[model samples]
Target chain A: MPDSNTNVIEIRNLTKSYGKNRGVIDVSLEIKEGDIFGFIGPNGAGKSTTIRSMLGFLKIDSGSISILGMDSVKDHTEILKHVGYMPSEAWFYGDMRVSEVIKYAADVRGLDCSEEARKLCERLKVDTHKKIKELSLGNRKKVSIVCAMQHKPKLFIFDEPTGGLDPLMQKRFFELINEYVAEGATCLLSTHVLSEVNKYCKNAAIMREGRLTMLDSPKIDDETFLSFYDDEG
Target chain B: MKTILTKELKLNLKNFLIWSLVVGGMGFVCILLYQSMETEMADMADAFSNMGAFSDAFGMSTLSIASLKGFFATEVGTVHGLGSAMFASILAIGILSKEEEQHSAEFLLSLPVSRKKVITAKGLCVLIMLVAFTAICTLLYCLAFLIMGEGIEASLFIAYMLRVLLMNIEIAGICFSVSAFSGKNRMGTGIGIALMFYVFDLMGRVVPDLKDYLFIGPFSFANASEIMSEIEPKDSSFIVGIILTVLGVATAYWIYDKRDISS
Candidate 1:
């Protein structure tokens, strides 16, 4: 477990909703520096909503989120400078080549990611010359991975990061996460895949219907953990 | 902001080219028709005057198509105005909603940039594209005039083009605000707003009672014939256009700042 004194992300009663639809309610979490935190939830369980709210993407109805000791809403632009995010569904300009897409990401973050991006692409075995539209799902996922990692942000937020990766690539991705954690970076991995949380995360939070139902060390097996969904229904 | 601007420009370059060609082509065809119809100018004028309902709807009641400038103002200018307004509407509506429509909002909004900056950058890109489209249309108009060996007063022509540009920006601002507040229905709402404004302007011209409400629609401010004439430009229309644009943009910014991004 990471030292409790060095919390990288602090959420207090975060609530965001769409009209009457439930998004997330009274969600609060604390992720310490260098901790591999897993956010486990089924489809439409508000995992993305919570992460997006923390990242200042969605406006909250009530509550507060602070990252790196700065308020997420008030200091959004500054906070983003130190964060790397991988969304659940990867998308890019369809007409752009893979290299151009990566370069564009680097440009947006004001970083010269050429060397690191090239190395990451090589390691991920992603083709740099293919148009974004022509890349397969897994390949596009690889591009997103490279883009997210190239900046070497202090905090990494991954939403369903392994959806399109093969088993081999998924293993390699976990290894990369471990490497980053070893370097004192915090990671929030949101996924419904219980096996991923059990194998990699030290602490996991389970969400159902836009509320956190569990937050503890991963002690149950994958099948048992998934049975929580059935029990709730 | 710079990065977003560059990306927007890159993505919409093809769209800009296509819209320019369509608008410019309409101008070209109109100018060519003027040459073929020159000999029958008197008859054409009489026919348009007799078609009272049609003239009122098109704002051609007082226009004499016998002259090249009058024909260009009433026919070519109206088409160009409508086309440019549509293009602006599409650009504004697509600016923010396309991300959600394509399910890429997650990827974009996750970046370090704030939501306000994102909107500002995209809005700037839309404005720049509208300016470019207007400039291209103006150049095409000038080319047609030169080919037909007709020289219009340079200042009047410029004033007319400036009005067109302002009108387009006004429509874009309204549509952009609509997009910010709406979700999947943004495009439909934007186009509908433009169409409604157009219909309102037509009604204002056709119905004497509604003429007093001409300030409600943007088309009322964009009078091509008045612009081409030597009379001083109407400051009331300009003021109204400016107010609507400011209000629209301010509303957009405020709503987007508070709105939730639905999954």
Candidate 2:
């Protein structure tokens, strides 16, 4: 029942809550195969909530989610095998060297990503010899990027991936993403950066306070990007 | 499963070594000291037995300290039982929760592995460490006995160690359930649970009204004095402990798999 050309990610009336946190309510969206879908929303606008729910991190109160044309909860193991997720703040074993961490991730997925991992380290300027505790925030981000990207997954889900990156590194990060897209990978980029959305995302969903303000807002320029970014869409 | 198992085993090695050394070393030192205290122990055993409620609580009233077996049953047995239980509690209580406490669950669960497999791997770590701790401590005790020029009753010693292992497994299983329910490290609470069980067993031995309900706590079947004396452990307590351990592990899987994991 797994359809390779079906919607890469789909959510229908998803709802979740945690105490007073503004958990996503009735959030729904779909990303087609090979689409660079931007999930643009401010902090606490349910971007991470929706994303986490899709990955089966948070249990939804109602509604459903499916990934790669399979039930998200029922087929979670299968879905994750083809998806590469980079969280907002990546935490790794501090005692391990960067190379060991990469190998550990690869080992978990039963993957041999040595060559790809080496290339990603070089592209991201990651120092493989240093322990994770010794790295700066930007360097840690680079390591997480390699862990998520080295597998060359069919779907890439990055939640605020550029937070600690320098401007140059951020540009290079997009370059890598673009290269992956060219290789037939679908991506879901969750960020509040309007410029990244306008520059890269052909179609984006804007969220405000746990609600989707704009569903699949087509390509827009700087002015319209600002309006949609400000919740004026 | 292999990946998580290897990673957890590697991460937990230092901790396991430290705890094993502390408990096993103390037991070894205590056993070595007993050879020098042999004459005094024969005289003081009477006073200890007469200590009334305190002696009853520690099983000293029933098992004299005049002989090596009695001394081991009353002293070294207490050390191993309480030490291993605490170790099992602390180890299992944090294995799953530490991922969230360290903010690594988001990274770990995001991988291709399922939550069930992750918890199973951690549970296996707790079980393996408990076994290793028991083996090391048992070996240290045997060495101590050799140094003291005493021969242990092999069957009794083996039975005691097996009982201790079962008790630790039960304690660890209970705490494993707690770890799944609590997203944060609760070492203090785990230690508290171990101590509470100790007190329950202690009180159950000293207080007649509580004796019948000893089956509720793990120590009832693991009473060092009873095991050394070849007295059959309360059958009800043994059966209940096994049932609870099964239920505890089952509950852990149910709760951890169903509950939402926060970043």
Candidate 3:
């Protein structure tokens, strides 16, 4: 009984903890369909924690989490089918070739990895035959991005997706996201790049110390922000 | 689960080869022990009457080098069985956390599969590896036995090999459960399980009162180790070991399905 126009992600009073250390607390937000959502937070601000919980990778201490209108914990399999995730600290089999790693992921998802992998590799201009151990960090990030996007997921969730990329590649990455959004795909990105946030995200949520400080459209007070960045450049 | 099992089987085949070589190496060493025992046949005959002290000291009293079946039961087969158990332990400890180590956990878990499905797949992989390792060791031992002209009962030998497989499965469950609860302490979990296994064996030997409580041991079939040596056929511990193994796997699944995967 899901509404067709329901939000892609809905979190209400979600809480998580590790022993006595707090991970995330009292976090509530709703990301609508086709929204390019930017999750802006400092280190240990529970950005990754919230993302993990929504993917059913972490247990909730309290509150509710849903993805594509399905309960994250109870309906995880159904929801994950539509979501493509890119983690901040991505790793692959060092002995495996990039192509093989992508194929392995595609095999797990029951998708045609070869065609999609080739297409993504072409788009990213990344060589897929190199062993993961031989690749630099930025190259590795590119591999992860290609793999995440290959399946044409309805919801794309990226955590520090472009941390190691150069300016040119970063720009290309945004272009890819923008293309997806234009095709009506929903995205949630977590990053420290406020400049990217200014350019890419129409809506953003800022967090501090495991709490939500603001959730609003970047279009708000744009004149003031624009003046600051324009003068600095 | 099928995908996980196939991948695990392929990955561990290399490890299984290494352990099989180690077990074969033990057989080579046993040939030296046998040659020396033959040279000292008179002294060994006198020593044989004092079985209790020898069993207590080396657990080798019941083995007879003169007979091929006993030679295998004591030398090559025993080592192969123990080596297979260690191999199973390593796989169980390494598989789940290895994904995290390689940073593949994020990619793997992101599939259209639930956390429960992922754990189920990993558990299945561990079992498949254990079974495949055990089978390869048994085949190698049988081939060696034929070459050595060891005329052991095929049925009894098969039973013995099956016993090793079950014991290995039980140990794998123990190690896997430890691995599942472990976040950053994966190596610690492996070492802890192995240490506890040895400590339990030591306690069973040192304290006569604890002999009946072998259930407390990390491994259920150390008493069966005595049986493998032909010292005593204590069959009561087998059921307890199997039951505990089931419980351990269930607990591992419960914990893994709910716990967060952190790098």
Candidate 4:
């Protein structure tokens, strides 16, 4: 029988370090089927590190990280098929046009990217004709956002997804998140944008100093959490 | 693998067009320099012989003021050794490093393909680019001779061309190996090639008695005057050079396949 739990992502003692510089230590979490999971942290609080390790972008020192129930280090190639990742920086080839960048990404992902690309571009208001170097920072962020969500991946991994977006675009992005969550797919978004969790996330994992400090539902009052943070700092 | 190789070939073609204009144009000027020499052929040989063992040491035996092929062996060898190797190394290093430098490694690795497959594909691309470059250089050399009313034998020409080809493989292999293991791509190619060139030249001077023994060194390989005129490469040295090339390629693939690429 298939496992009914269907945990899309699971981590147990996930740790990484660069020599003496600690990235993350013993990060353990689980996101079951059909959940909007937010990973929150202050700057340099291991949010990107944990997310990158999940995507097999950085090596862990001594720990286990798994995606789609498969071991992360050993089965990353398999995991990638079902995941859509949006990096915080969104650095792309400067010479590539927005359309070419999307097309190239789709090709790499082993998908017929054209139809889906057109739909995403239209929805995201991305002008594919312009070169990436020519695009404004927010526009570039939009292009990356479109690329990440377009394939309808089984899981979406966005690290600081709204980093350069305006308030208007951020609102539109949240609506898109709601629609994605409704479809019973999973989303793991890493950001400092706390308001987003209150607006959409089912639950969130708060991080500090490369460790998980809190994991709870957004149904808790935001003002109460803010007070707890203010008192601690 | 084939797809990645095709992309690499396309990129190298652009590099080739640019370098050919630079190297080939310089080659034409060198040919003019050879023609303008005031000394007669016999007088040149006599003057070279007076330099004793140094003449043989520097490959002055075949350094005629007359033979255009010999002139090319002397001058073009210097030109291609430094210029072409630098150009090729840049492209080869970029094969793996460029993706990471542009933050595309994570994006590319996220594909369905395995990391091993990516490394293999990129390596194949580098190999193909090196072979294509050798063939083009040989063709251009032959064409230049034919156009200039010189009747060079195709077989002999081809044999000399293979020497140049193998020499490039050695340089490419070293650069590829460095790029594979290195986190910093910029330094790997430039430093790798420059170090190889320096080692060869230094060995030629410092260990004067062992100059012939150090044929495996890149400086010796780059010195085309000696390589072109000699009927057979020093057996052990030539074999060692080939072995080094193999070692370089093997080390690169092994390191790349196993190393953690997350960051």
Which tens-of-lDDT digit does each residue in B112-166 have in candidate 2? 8999999999999999999999999999999998987895699999888889999
User: What TM-score does each of the candidates earn?
Assistant: 0.94, 0.95, 0.88, 0.89
Best by DockQ: 2
**Share of the reference A-B contacts seen in candidate 4:** 0.51
TM-score, chain B, predicted structure 1: 0.93
Stretches of candidate 2 above 4 Å error? Answer: A1-6, A19-22, A215-233
Model 3 regions lying over 4 Å from their true place = A1-6, A219-233, B28-45, B48-52, B56-59, B185-211, B214-232
Model 2 is docked with a DockQ of 0.82
Lowest lDDT block of 10, candidate 2 chain A: A1-10
Model 3 Cα lDDT, one tens digit per residue, B140-192: 65665556554467766676767677777787887777777775437556656
Rank by lDDT (best first): 2, 1, 3, 4
Query: Candidate 3 at residue A171, lDDT?
Result: 85
On a 0 to 100 scale, what is the lDDT of residue B168 in model 4? 65
Q: Could you tell which candidate, 1 or 4, scores higher by DockQ?
A: 1
Clash count, predicted structure 1: 0
Q: Who is ahead in lDDT, 1 or 4? A: 1
Q: Which parts of model 1 have CA positions greater than 4 angstroms off?
A: A1-5, A213-216, B56-59, B231-234
Top candidate on lDDT is 2
Clashing pairs in 4: A57-B262, A58-B262
Q: Whose lDDT is higher: candidate 2's or candidate 3's?
A: 2
